[model samples]
Target: MTTLLLAAKAAVAVLLLASGGAKLADLAGFAGTVRLFAPARSSGWVVAAVRHAAVMIAAAELMVGAVSLCWPALTWVNLAVLTLTCGFVIAAGLGYARHRGRPCHCFGALTKRGFGLSSLLRAAVVLAAAIASCMPVRPAPQLHFTLVFHLLLLAGAVLMAAAAAAAAKALLTQPDSAGTVA
Candidate 1:
């Protein structure tokens, strides 16, 4: 069970790390796609700030996953990551469903991956893996209560929101290379 958990954690960590790294490196592509989704994409400061901050958040998530893999006992930390990640995927699925066939910048603009049923399925699989991993981690009854689970979720929400907000603020203020609003 521990071995399985470790393997899953490592795989997730690597995947997220790579994906996040790609986005961090290519801000323009991400910004362009986000321009499609973000209501304030037109604001040069907003887009630039958002692009860079999103990259940092992605990197942090990947790094956390990697470290958690090294310490399976830290599996609880994944509860937050998985839940938030699942939420992101589901949201993307909904967008694709409405748009019929939109490219999923979920990985970053660099990948050119599109969103669809496949994307939704992938999210479900990861969500399942995350839940399965927690099962073994909390074999004891009381230790696995909903409160503990929710607390982790709340933390994830706060962190993700904070990061997003910071990114937005930056985008609202940043200037283009020519000192013009991006």
Candidate 2:
């Protein structure tokens, strides 16, 4: 049961970190998606401010997940991560409903390959998983596994962000430059 709990914690951290990192990597795209749902479409400055806020919130999520999972001190991070997941649920639902058949910029290109209800449901479940991690944990002497898991997770996140940037650059460049991006 203790091992199960640890696995759950690790999975939740991975899911949250991935989603948050994806959102943070594409601020303008996420903001544009938010603007579609938001009422502040007319005001240019309002849209920009709202977009930045969304990015900041996503940044908070990425940081919280990393710290809570990788760092030794638990430090109320589980609570913060749970809160972040709940917020993401709200955003995903709202984004889904508002789009009404449009693509979501939530997961960026990652989800574009395949869309599923399970994805959204999994995010909701992750909220519970995060809170569970906050509960009284069993005495597990294997701290090294935890450390290794988190480091690998963090490294994967960095690579994913880099991949997103590369994809975005490729998409933005014109056809004139085949191998070379303008």
Candidate 3:
């Protein structure tokens, strides 16, 4: 049970870290997606606000994932993960209902998968993992991390973020089906 719980925790943490990093790689693209759900027009002050919101959302995901990985014993982190997952669910549903077949950019350019049932299913799985990780387990030996270990974990998180950004940027630079650079 403990092992399962730990795996769930790790899965969600990595998921968030990768997602946040990818979004950061293409802030303008993400803001375009955000505009689909916003009531505000896509001009002037509203555009700037939307871009900032995109940054905050991506930063929140990165911070939450990094903190969760560095301090797994922190029970409150579970709640934070759960909250993010819930937002994912909402996004998936709205994307499907109002913007079906549109690229979600959920993983930036890592995928071109549009919003659909599969997106909802993916969100559901993440939500389930978040919930499972939050389940209480029998008292087990508490795992402790040294300062060096924590630093290593943080380093890994940074690498994951950088990798996602690189991959997304590479994909964006590739030629499209029409053979024109995108």
Q: Which stretches of candidate 3 lie over 4 Å from their true place?
A: 40-43, 175-182
TM-score of each: 0.61, 0.72, 0.90
Clash counts for all predictions:
7, 0, 0
Estimate, for each residue in 1-182, the C-alpha lDDT of model 2 and write its tens digit.
66666776767766656666666666665676666666743777777777887788667766776676675246477778778878767766665455444445556444442113644676578777876776656564443456577688568766654565456444433322122233
Candidate 3: tens digits of C-alpha lDDT, residues 1-182: 88888888888999899889999998877887777788744568887888898898889899999888877777898899999999999999999999887778788777778789999999999999999988875563344668898899889988988898888887876542222244
Pairs of residues at least 3 apart in sequence or in different chains that clash in candidate 3:
none
The positional error of residue 102 in candidate 2, measured at the CA in angstroms, is 2.5
Q: Output the number of the lDDT-best candidate.
A: 3
Worst 10 residues of 1 by lDDT: 172-181
lDDT agreement with native, every candidate:
0.56, 0.62, 0.84
Once model 2 is optimally superposed onto the true structure by TM-score, how far is the C-alpha of residue 38 displaced, in angstroms?
A: 1.7
lDDT of 1 by residue, 43-154 (tens): 7777776676566656666555544443445556677557656766766666567633455555553345566677777777776676666656434342233656546644
Best candidate, TM-score: 3
Score candidate 2 by TM-score against the native.
Answer: 0.72
